[model samples]
Target: MTIWHRSARFHYRFATNRPVAPATGVVVDLSLNIVGDFVSHGGFRNYNPDITRPTPHLIHSGHGTMAFGGRTWDVGPGDVFVFFPGLPVEYADDPQRPWRYRWIGLEGPLALPALASIGLTPSQPLGRIGDPATVDRLLAEALSGTVERAFPPTRHIAMAWQLVAAIAAKPPAVDVDTVVHQLATGDPAAPPSITAISRRHRIAPSTVYRRATATLGIAPKAYQLERRFDLAQRLLAGRTLPVRDVAAQCGFNDANYFARAFRRRYGVAPSQWRSGQI
Candidate 1:
């Protein structure tokens, strides 16, 4: 049986240094005096608010995959994820540990232009930012509210730019195909089993299993199960079909069993979850 986890209870504080250049004027000053744990245990999807201005987001990982922008990626400790401007992102942790992270939004005239200088764009689904120390400092400061006092608005905005520049300067060696393959093979909506996937790829089951585990850090079957669970969640969110019908369509034979599994994974019954969404 899968034991589920929930997001961490964490908080942060944010304040910006005053700007010297009018071009670099601070457009927004957010204070993260306190923030609830941003990660979700069991598996949950939440929508990101629409944004017209460039905003910076911070993501800390839990023990499971975090889904955003129609892709799922593995997250471990000390990992940092950035979502820039107007894009939607959602995340959830695994059965053992829910996703735990802190994030805030900042939009101003200089944001995108600064990011562009570093090869960072607002449109990509996801990317990492900064070294571990930088990420650590940012989070610690935000959570502890130290940045509010230690840095002025100008300095803070400059720091944000530095972070973006670091991301832009990093080599683009990340394997795009590897990420796509995971989404294609692991998404529950697709429901292609290891055997079926292996055949499709013209490889042995052991080879497929080994590759997914080695590259994705997840056993193939488990990955598929996660994807299937994601599909069920989406169907439930759509509110278009009966939960029993959803269970059948998603390949679970028993609706009661499915409900139990969903609740255990999501920390709420399907009905309750749907209600809360409304």
Candidate 2:
């Protein structure tokens, strides 16, 4: 494999001296690119470029959006897209939030057939999988090192095949239970909002609200607050940290506001709750 590019933000590009024959399914190039927010202008228009590329490419977006094929897709994390060989297509980052993605370029007589069997085509080349993290990990493992001696060709082929299979498998829809759990235990730094969650799951906000309320017997907001307060209670009970610190840890920035919210929820100050006093 020849390294065309490498970067600390996990951008990688590679090519092989010996192309995979039409008989053996194999990957010719693979890349993991984290096009950060710093990228101001990034777009590609491919219309039978001078260079010949005899392989289909599969791209998995970790985050951000892209405009392609005469429409803009709100490509959230875990979304996948494909580009067939010799096709004319244009794509660009959503300037506001640049994308991070992994792509595998594949060559073989079975490439298009395999992709078609799974309903991925140039016209409709988007799909999702059960485990985006696992796919990302596999791509990382297959493309590790300085590209001087990355994974051997055989290993790379195997990894690429595995990824192809995963993509071909129909992914289950995001369920209401999973959304509820995410709201309850999502990252404090990036609390899950109804809009964001709905977008991530590719559903309407109203659907998320209706499903969550039907399943959990509480509005999503109320459920999230209950979980946040539960976390706050645990933090208060387990530590000697200041009330303000506990509040911040629970996703509240203002101590007074946090206290008021806590009082409304528990009928006691956070300090009093910590002290087991009603």
Candidate 3:
């Protein structure tokens, strides 16, 4: 069997491994991998820079926007896009109409060649497949291995091979990135400079800056700051950290500046907000 196929079974078995706590006076150490199936409401609203690859069938189901190679495309129900490795992509929820979808995460390296036969190329950006019944059947088969509890390790490996075959046979459009961009910039605290972000992601600085302004309507640095500040607000409300420390953790070099920024965004100081919450 191919390495990709072997990886699929490895991941499936790892995910299904049951954990057993140690008995009295004994410690049990096991590197158990966990896999889960879930349905989520609301839309995905962030650019995932970590662990997202141009794998076949990486995306399960959802509606959102994918920005690739200087173009932004709308994705909704019945839309599927495939990407290649090392490509920079960003996705966010539609503000006017959010999304709800089923999702699963698998870790392995087998099943690519079979998938490639279906048009999943490391060079392709986005591909669309609109067949509902086939999609459902593939999903069902994947789930069968997950739900059977004691299904043999080889069975899951086999199921993964089947899953890839099913996906490759379907028709879809692959959307590729025009240019890669910085992965993190727009958080709640401060947006880093485009030059800084671009350098980090190894793409042209201009591309990072342009995409941030054109697609997100804000600079990359500004977007990053928002995320920092957003986290600060949560920490403050939870009373987990002191004000000065919170400011530092949120990326503010000065407590006074953090306080000022906090007031401007939430209309109250962090300390006051924390006390009010209490």
Candidate 4:
């Protein structure tokens, strides 16, 4: 029931401020405006307490058990885990063989889907990275992004993404259905070009279109639109978040555009749709 952390939280603007960990339940807002927090501490430590992480983070460490989302694991150097936002977490380093770990946080609406496309989600977070040093090295490189004197924030963030892309398998894919599913479920706002999909997977554009239509019963673009609006409706119905957050979660970064598109799809603006205003 004790928590220990040597925190150096770097917010956006790359300010030189090392604040202690925010108390549990204090949420970190992952706005598209690009605010962030990067926490990394080297050397031996044991930390365990209920912590709700703000942004999705990748963790690599040795000699400890990570208790995440009610699952406990005896993790080693080759063990890497993802901590998505809003999940409960606890970690304890083995006193005998102490370890170090880093949290390279990811933001934006696309981050979660991109990770999920590779089979990394809160429900299934642990993975065997097999090369702890490479992961640790990437973490170190990403951490430098927090220092004001280091590289620009965007470069560091891209480096963070590079680390993520390096871990491949990386999903339950290979079948035509899976590939089609990946495309349909990718970022809703900017769907990748059909040509790019064909080139990457070595499939002819026409065949991809034919199979995708057969698999989903609709064009890929239409499938994505329906999927996006389905979630938007539920979120709007809940009324828990503002239109902006709803839009962001549904892969619409611009609230204004989200409103315009909402009207086009549902025949009502998001604000009006929430309360059934004609």
Better of 2 and 3 by lDDT: 2
Q: What are the Cα lDDT values of the candidates?
A: 0.54, 0.59, 0.51, 0.57
Worst 10 residues of 4 by lDDT: 10-19
Give the per-residue Cα lDDT of candidate 3 at 46. 53
Please report, as a residue range, the 10-residue window in candidate 1 with the lowest summed lDDT: 28-37
lDDT of 2: 0.59
Name the candidate that leads on TM-score: 2
Q: How would the candidate models be sorted by TM-score, starting from the highest?
A: 2, 1, 4, 3
Alpha-carbon shift of residue 138 in model 2 (angstroms): 3.2
Write out the backbone clash pairs for model 4: none
Using TM-score as the yardstick, the better of models 3 and 4 is 4
User: Which regions of candidate 4 fall more than 4 Å away from where they truly are?
Assistant: 1-61, 130-134, 150-153, 169-278
Write model 1 residue lDDT over 152-243, tens digit each, in one string.
43445555555555444443343434543754564364454555444333356676566667766777667677877878878888988898
Residue 116 shift from truth in candidate 3, angstroms: 2.6
Please, what is the TM-score per model?
Answer: 0.43, 0.52, 0.40, 0.41
Which residue pairs show collisions in model 2? none
1 versus 3: better lDDT goes to = 1
